[model samples]
Target: MRLSLAIAMAEEKVKEGGKNKMSDKKWFNKGAKAGKVEKREKLLKTYEKAIEVISKYAVTLFIKGFELSELGRHKKALKIYKKIIKLFPQLNVAWFYKGFELSKLGRHKKALKAYEKAIEIDPQYAEAWSNKGVALSELGRHKDALKAHKKAIEIDPKNALAYTNLGELFFKLGNLKKASENVEKALKIESDLVPALNLQGRIKIEEKAYDAASESFKQAMSLDGANPVHFLWDTYTNYLKIGFNLDSEDKKYQEEIATIIRNLEKMNETLSKNQKQEKEMRAYVLYFLGHFYLKSNDILTAKEKLEECIKLKSKSSIKASARELLGNIWNYRIKPPWWRWWLNSPLYRWPKRFGFSILLLLISALLLLHPFIPGWFPLLQINWSLYAFLIVLLIIILFLPNIKRIQIKGIEVELQSPPPYEPVLSPTVMEEIMKEIEAKYTKLE
Candidate 1:
């Protein structure tokens, strides 16, 4: 009996030991899960901290850059923005603003590179694509410009600016139907859009749809008053050219110019006299006033107004028209000093600048290398053979196949299986693909 009792006690202890092992395993699994949760939370906190750290360092730099841009110190803005990009490579806004500042400075190629970098960082960046297209348009790469605009539209279907840009491109290409379609789409999205409305009116005028164009321009004027564009001036004058008592439309044109003159006076008065905007307003008003006088066949008042416009702002587009009109007068237009010869020999209009640059560079470089290379040897001696060799090498590189070639002669081939038949696209299918690619050329942004 004692032996049997002891055996039972041992069995109970073994069972208890097995339960304890299972409990320990469950506790361990729960601890592991808790540890993983803590690690994930820590990671989230670290990411937030990184973002905060970057923001603290980058935001002030961006602000300083913007202030520089506003001050018209574009080079400074570019440098600051570049620094921001280098310091915070993930900051797409810095790249974007840098491109904008470069565009303002007329550095289209550099602006394009900056915008491309921004787009590379964030492919869905609609503004970058639009601005890139603008730079391309300025560079006269219109087909590429259209592609970028369409790309922006693709990323954000609601982007009215992209549609307007596309419309302008189509208009320039003389695809009036497509232009109308796109501009109308932009207007439908934002009825108050003055630029699209104004352009639509211009296109209508070009198409000789007088009433339609007038309505379009009138709507544009209602939204944003008094543009300096000659289109608005010409549209008004054409309306005035309408013969009275003949067509009702003729009276309409005459009345429109009168209304435009009144609106111009209001626009000029509304602008502050102390501001630069005032100068632009005055220049435009005087230019249009001159146009009005010229239309009435009063050459003297036209000459006076145009000369006044010329004196107010040297950079106005109206300055060109003013110079043309004033050509019959004293004609003291600020003609280029080398105006006569510039057309014939543009490169030599100021050849001295280039000569001076070359001489200065040569002198500085020779001075630096005086101990090694004397001035005479540096100035007179030319390495013709080196240049020739470089040119020949470049020619060879251009003519050669771009792909790298490899030889497999030494490698043992598997004695072979039957060659598999590969299905390939036919000529017709390939042609279709080419056309598809051409279509994509319209929307590569």
Candidate 2:
């Protein structure tokens, strides 16, 4: 019986030991699971913090890039944007800014790709779409540009920039009416938008509405005080358009010319110091000022300005224009050759100036010399001298004023043809020129 009890005790001990082993295994598994959960939570927290730090760094870099762009360091800005893109490939704004810098650098094709990437990342990127339209326009894909602008407008109905861009495109296409309508819409949406105001002014100038165009440019100048040179230049040129059409002797003609000079001076003052230092800008200013003075018959002042412009190292085209105007002035200053003096001589007026005196002298000479003259001479035929005198006297009385009138008319006509310089503001030429200027100088929307 003792042996059986011992065996039973051993069996009990074995069962208890098995149960302990199972319990130990369950506790170890539970602890291991808790430790794994803790580790996973810590990893997730670390990941979230890392993302937060990267996002903050990206924002900082973006601001730096924008500041560089504002300073006109587009190449440097491009590098910053590229770095941002490398870090955060999904950032649409980074892509858009990359495109902006590229456009500023005149790489429109590359800019178009960057803008497309931004749009692909975020289809509702209105600014990207609008800028893409500009790239397309630069590429001469007008239809695609139009579609892109329209899409931008559809995406954001209040996109004044898109409207202005659309208007500019229409203007390029020679649809002045449509251009005006769209530009007007842009102005309505944002009354103080400088680009819209400037475009409106350009359209009115095309329509020959000088007064309205002046007002629009003036408004633009006021609103865009920091960059008023363009508006000021436009206003000056608009006055020039009016002045060129006016009779020099008109009471208001000198006043108009004076206004043009004042506007130009204001433009000079408005130019930034760096711009003032630009030989090209100074050449343009001097050339136009000289041109205006030349038109107003201020030969000395015109010669001075033109000479100054010619002496500067400027663009070939501006220098060429200056040289041409200078040549005109030189030709004008030279007295006509002796043979052509009759064109302006008192004798040219004939009967109006000296006919009566000459006829009397002739009659006296004939009376004095009649006795000495040959009898067969035609001068002694049938008292012909008296008839000649009477006819000459009649012509003097009847046609003197008419002759003076004709002389004045001829002077006016000559004055009209004196300025052979083709105006820089010829509609087609000015449109392209101003568009280029705006592209260069105007800030991005």
Candidate 3:
């Protein structure tokens, strides 16, 4: 009986051992599954962080490219934008900016392709559509350009740039009424839009509203204080056109011509170094100056300016115009006598500082000689002794330097006998003056 009991106990122990082993295998499988779940969660978190980092990097690169483009470094900007597109093919803004740079570089076909790619990525991109219209217009695909601009306006109802672009297109198509309407709509939406204002000025010029066009250009210049070259050129050309349209003997015609010449001289003084370096701008200015002088009957000055314009490597059209004007001067226009040329030269022209004094002196001399000359008109009688005192005072005024004080943007500037040929304050001088004023104020504060 004892042997049988001992065998039973051993069998029970073996069964318990098997049960424990099965439990151990189940725990091992559960632990392995939990470890795999944890590892997958870690990998997923890492991937999300990597994607976020890449997105931020792309945004940073895009901003850099945009800044470069704003600084007029389009080629460098294009490379940066291209790099971004290569790294992040899905970035739509990169493609859009790539198109902008390409358009600036005059590669309209490639710009169209880039813009199309952007539109494909984001169909709602209104800017892309509008700029694509610009490319199309430049390519002479006017119908397609119109469609693109309309689509942009449809996508974003208040897109002022798109409206302005549409206005420009209509102007090209000779639909002045439609062009004016769209430009007005654009101005209504964004009153300070410089391009819209410029377009408005151009339309006004076409409509023969000279005063209103002047106002529009002035507004544009005020709004675009940093770069008003386009507005200046437009205004100058419009004034020239007005002067040409009027009768040469009309008082208004002479006034208009004088205004243009004065403004051109002022522009020459204020031109930045960069602007002075622009051969095209210089050529245009010279051509217009020559044209103005020719109209004013100053043949010698006109010839000089036209000759200078022809010497510059400029646009074919401008050079051709200069050549034609020179031909007309040589072939058709009568040359003025040497004495008239001397009188019309810069030295004998009315001096800015002593012009009024000189006029007064001439009147006084006429009064002093009244007794010796035959009186053509008895109504011109005056007190001789009083006129002699006036003559002395006028002589003093003419010989003495004039002191003038002017306030510009809350800064007081003093002048003594300002130069007759140049503006008293040029752009470079104004900048320096502003800086000095700011520095002084900072010190005082």
Candidate 4:
């Protein structure tokens, strides 16, 4: 009986042990699931904080890049901006700024690509579209430039820069009337806009509205105090090309000349004060001064300045101009070849010039005299009509566009095409932006 009882008790103890093992397994699975849930919540919070930190860091980097760009350190700005773009490919503003810096460096083709990428990211970006137009214009693709400007205007009618770019394109196309109208629209939208003001001045000069053009230039200078050197250089080049008739002694003409000289003197003073002015810049000022004095009929001063320009020899075009002018001063005058002058002259009212009428008369006279002079009048039957034609051609050549006197005015000034303007974002604007960024960062903290 005792042996049977021991066996039964052992079986009951085994069943209780099996039940305890199953209960412990269930408790272990429940605790493991709860621990996993806690870990997932903590990881999610960490990612959120990381994203916030990254965003703040991006804003700070952008400000640094902007400050570098403002300081004319374009390559450094590009490095910072490229880093931002690599980390945040979706940031359209970063692409726009990259394009702007590229444009500043005169890498218009690369700038265009950057702008296109920005546009792809955000088609509604008006500044990007407008800047794309500028890039196209720089590439000499006027038709495409017009299309881009129109697109910007379509996206945002109030985009002043779009209108300014439109004006510039039309000016290039020689549609001065349309250029003026578009420039007017830009100025109306934003009167203090420097580019619009400068462009308006260009249009006014083309229209022969000298006073209006002068006012526009003065306004641009006032608005662009940060770069006085540019103002002086631009103003001098524009008026010099306007073909001012100094011999007329017109009051407006005198005042304009006086203003140019005064500005040149002021430029010298400014340069003397700022030793940072490069040797090339000083050479350019001398070249401009030479031309200014030449136009003012101060031949002695002009000769001195031009000689200095040749000595420096910084810019090839300026050096060439100085040499040519010096030769003219020495030789009384040195004219361009007749054929070149004719080709360079404006086609407007060309028929009214003496060359055209004289050619017509000589042709008529040759035809009338053709029969009177025999075909075989002289040796070996040289056609007399051919001789008459030759004589007429010789006479026509004599009257061809200032062949006798070297007129180095008007279309004769073959200056190099104007350098592209620098990027126009002001320090004040950047400072405001930095302030906004700091405010946002503090609020987030």
Candidate 5:
């Protein structure tokens, strides 16, 4: 202790003697200042450590929120998203996710607001713009959706999703020409894109370009493999209906039917090979096969296929559509009523359509004669034979066609058959149908 004091005293004496009039803080004061500086540095380090830790935690939380959202637990997703926003208010993805979840909740206006907020943070956020447009489209604000979609395109011109959305908006607005153009452009830009291909298929179907439409659907199916339930059914129905109509034509009818048989056989083969087909898909295939048989005017095959569709998916929209189609089959197959022969009576087709011509002429002649010859005088002087002719003409012109449209449809088997046994046949036909229940009915193993 004595040596330490002597060294300190020596250091101070040398400093005082050598210094150019410099003063020193007291030793206790110097130590106190040093302690304060050390404390400040420690506080800064602590804050730095805290910020580093927070950044790591934020990323982890963000990922967990996304996972929850993707899993379709929207309430949990919303909670997690809100928490992330609370912790990191500037996160653009969190805002986007919140907007998307709000859209799922059907709060379109709130979704738009959330998307707008995301855009405010990052103006070039193309996905936010596209999502905002989707919400607007869902709300039936096609004009606003168009603008939002355009902005997304401007922000990211290469984004295929934005173009697909724009096409959908145009399609909703009934701007078919524009919708077709935009979706086609999107497909051109990204040929393998699923939604654009689907949209193209939808547009083609609307335009009745059946072959082109079929190709587009196949493309989408190839890309996505298993289509969503409604989409698959709709595409299948369209193909069936179009094929039926086109095959009804005189030329190439046989070829078209042959193609249908080949395709259905191939589809059946694929389904039988343990493919993972959905119930809705199986129902649709069966239903369309029923239609295929119905188009060929095969009652037994059609009946079997229709019943099989009901068996596989007994309680679904497919069942309802099949019922409607089955009813139509009976409706179109009706025979002409007996009253049709008398009503059609040849007069309606030949004279009724142009009978007004003769009446107009007669009225004109009467009017010309009436100025000189009073109306009463003409009736008194008219020959009894001419009066009879006018009477017969009146009966032939007006009443014949009217009688037919009301009572006479046509002459066919449906009119003679026992009350359409479609429903009753279901029980009895179940055994017969069991034979033709294409292996496709078994869900892919």
Candidate 6:
């Protein structure tokens, strides 16, 4: 504080000593540099002096606001931007940045208004249009987002962000072919674009091309350094799904699992940086952690993480997924451990058959003892009646489709055969679900 005051006094002394041009320019540069370098205390001091020195300089104010937004001090940046907009109502850039800051704060409707104002001021502003599309997308106005992105592209044919946004818009709309085309165009223009790469990876995953999807995610990770843990979570979860084969003993599979766990540990460190205030983020991270642990056969850890996820944010899709996974965990662990322990035993493969035979024998013994019951003769008779019943049962078991069986640890566990149920939600469907959730939350807010 004393140093800043001393610097401010020295700067003022230089300004008053007949060095008007040099001092004014130097002070403005110093203030701008302070903002850029995130010297917040110094910047605030310089901000007060800058108003007195270059009171008419709108560019300096915009630079300050931009720097604040970059530093994630979005509400403060919004205040600066609002002041800029009030003073220079015709400045499209001010409105554009106000919208940018508002969008950063998740005020999509206000962002849309600010973006619309910027567009109204300058129809050819491709960046504003692209950002408007993002705001529209966040607001669940898919059609408007499409139009805004298209308008951005029309205004500037080579705008890579416009192309990427268009690709994401198409992805949300479930037109994977068009999504792929636009993302490819974006990559052609800017190959290292993280969002485009992530979107491309998502599209690959939807097509069940897990290897290709993983490669794309790897490329994205290379481009996007490891600071923000959210992207890491996405990459880790993709790897988990691809490498998750509960019964696999393959060397390659084991290596992939090891890599995923290592990545997850690093992500855990990243999450710790802001975990306290990020309840939803905690839920997301824990959900994936639970999923990875489950796939890695760490049932206890999986159950713990998933239950933590539910307790943190009980309303999200992450919570729903966590609950589903927890139910699966309980169902799996409740079964006799011996069933899994004897995975290498010869009878393990046909344990269900042996168990079924034992059950039938018990029934036959009961029927023989209770011959007075109706149909006891046919039920107890094994010469032809029982043989016919066994034949019919074998045919039905062999030919007729029943519940899907997942062979886990040598046990053919029968999965619930949902009656011709709709397929699992794809990324597009998940987008709609998220939109619904956000809308509900917005209404509550």
The candidate that achieves the highest lDDT relative to the unseen native structure: 2
For residue 222, give model 4's deviation from the true position in Å.
1.1
Worst 10 residues of 1 by lDDT: 436-445
Query: Where is model 3 poorest over a 10-residue stretch in terms of lDDT?
Result: 436-445
Per-residue lDDT of 171-251 in model 6, one digit per residue for the tens?
888999999999999999889877777778778877777667778877876766542432542554456464455434677
Number of the candidate with higher TM-score, 4 or 5: 4
Instruction: List lDDT for all candidates, in order.
Output: 0.60, 0.70, 0.67, 0.65, 0.62, 0.66
lDDT of 4: 0.65
True-structure lDDT of candidate 5? 0.62
| Per-prediction TM-score | 0.53, 0.65, 0.60, 0.59, 0.51, 0.57
lDDT, candidate 2, 1-445, per-residue tens: 2122223333333445323333323433433444454665654544444355446657778888988887778999999999889868999999999999999988999999999999999999999999999899989999999999999999998999899999989988989999999998998899999888888887887787877887888888788875644564565556556655887688688778777877766655444256634455666667778767766777778778878777776754667767776766654453344323323322233542365456456657655676656665755555667756766655444333323233344563222234565434355544554555566567767
Clashing pairs in 3: none
Candidate order (TM-score): 2, 3, 4, 6, 1, 5
Write candidate 3's Cα lDDT for 211-291 as tens digits: 777788788778765443544545454564665488769988888888888777566445435554445556666776777
For residue 140, give model 1's deviation from the true position in Å: 2.3
Clashing pairs in 1: 147-442, 239-253
lDDT of 1 by residue, 403-445 (tens): 1332357765343232232222233332343233222122211
Model 5: per-residue Cα lDDT at residue 239: 44
Report the C-alpha lDDT of model 5 over 170-218, residue by residue, as the tens digit: 8777789999888878877899887787678767766767667777777
Clashing pairs in 2: none
Say which prediction, candidate 4 or candidate 6, comes out ahead on lDDT: 6
